[model samples]
Target: MIGKLSSKEGVVNVLVSWLPLEDNWYARILDENLTILSLYETGDILLANHIKLENFVIKNILKLSAIYCYCGNSLSTKAYGLAHDQIRKCLFDMNYDKSDIVFNTNSAQLCSECDANFDRVNLPEDFKKNLKKDLKKLKKDFFYRVYDFVQTKPKISIVIATIFALFINILSNYLYEIIMGRANLPIFLVSPFVVIWNYFT
Candidate 1:
């Protein structure tokens, strides 16, 4: 009934909001072209997860493509029975758990099985192929990308951080020597590791 608010006809309209739908699953397909997305949580739903609304919405649009292609414009819950049983990070995963949405939101695509199903869809030529390539756009922001890199490569991050600190410390000490015409730098200005080693000795 919420879809009735739109005055425009013959156009696909997807209205999204934080509405209390049944079970509050990630999104509900009201119609083939109209889907109402559920974002009913404050934290761990979007902002806390470092997910931008724009990227989230774009990802949902991709999901809808595969959904409608297989389901054939039906709004029935059973129409999506072909969804995968496990979370394969596919666009067709049955996300009974709301947290599972993060999987699709972060660099997910249609599984090979589901992509093969596109042959049955009456979509334009290469539509499904284009959608596959478009999945790269649904990535986490720069900060989260860097955070994930650090998480996966902690040793590399530590080494880089140590090198950066040493470079900055030496540059500061040299600048101080030139400005004050002094031959040496203060202990704290030299390097934290040097101070720690001297204290230990």
Candidate 2:
């Protein structure tokens, strides 16, 4: 099914197919302007919200875009072996296992080697920086981001949540005193639900 895909000038063409690629790859960059994405056995990825396929498509797009912008057709190969199985959450992670794509998508950063390589590239000044920022943005949903943050730093998360709750309490108390006129901050603090219910009734 991938045979009909033909590369075009001044464009990036990605062919998404269900046929298994050689070496069980999720995707492969055939040329600077062409990539092959396979859906075969993609269900094994075990990613959040069925993000495996989308991640593959975005990964190829961004990777090839950076390479093309950096050196046009002068760059020898795609950004595949740059990570060399390091799994450093870098945009160019080899991810030979394919499932490691999950890590590459979220928390992706430019490794020192790749960073230095980009420094020598032909792109404009901020291209690599923007690429890093964009790659980092391709992470899990907001709920999972907060969940992971709290899981990783329980104490800090608790402190931040407590501070937010306290600030909300203070703001609500002041607003209530202004709006309701007779509602004291002390009364609101003691039984907020009772005060609100009593006021309405």
Candidate 3:
């Protein structure tokens, strides 16, 4: 059993299972209550694409009260498991004081609890589609955060300068034709005037 929900009546427990990928393991999220709020085993997509799995859980399962992660024998070691310290650090980063989670090895006795009757429950048709959209948004948000972090440094000025140079290149020909009225003015000479004009306007 895990912690109680905010309602004190609706108990939410997330059960995690590890899937063997090519090199790394993928995790699947399943609520013990047989809810349709589950994410697919994204393999290395989460870590490789820099998607924030913790944010996904927090946004999609805002009402979750607890999480129960069951790992196989391979991940039974203290340093490696579905709910290891590395994962727990991210999960507990928010206001998780009211909720709790437990991780245990998949021993013979634990197999009984791990066997969830997922066939009986039919997920909605749009469940996977919605999950895909949410995942794309998560990846986008992660990149935006990374960009925000890097933008505060002095190196970002070089990026802005490069973009400005490209913008000037794109408009150089047109500005030259308009300025000389014969489409024969040198772009190098007209570019500075265009920049000054646009800046003043």
| lDDT (Cα, tens digit) per residue for candidate 1, span 1-201 | 233222222334566777677766657767646678766772257677788867777777666655554555434465466588789888777777777777777777778777767776686568777887888777888989899789999999999999999999989888888689876566666698887889999
Report lDDT per candidate. 0.70, 0.69, 0.37
The TM-scores, one per candidate, come to 0.67, 0.68, 0.29
**Separate clash counts for every candidate:** 0, 0, 0
TM-score of 2: 0.68
Residue 182 C-alpha lDDT in model 2: 67
CA RMSD of all predictions: 10.9, 7.5, 15.0
Q: Give per-residue CA lDDT, model 2, range 1-201, as digits (tens).
A: 332222233666667787899888877777656677786766457354345456556665677666666555422354554656788877778878867777776657788988888777577668777887777667666787788789999999999999999999988888788678865555646698887889999
TM-score of 3: 0.29
Identify the candidate with maximal lDDT: 1
lDDT of 3: 0.37
Query: How good is model 1 by TM-score?
Result: 0.67
In candidate 1, position 95 carries an lDDT of: 71
Backbone clashes in model 1? 0
Q: Which stretches of candidate 1 lie over 4 Å from their true place?
A: 1-10, 42-44, 71-79, 159-201
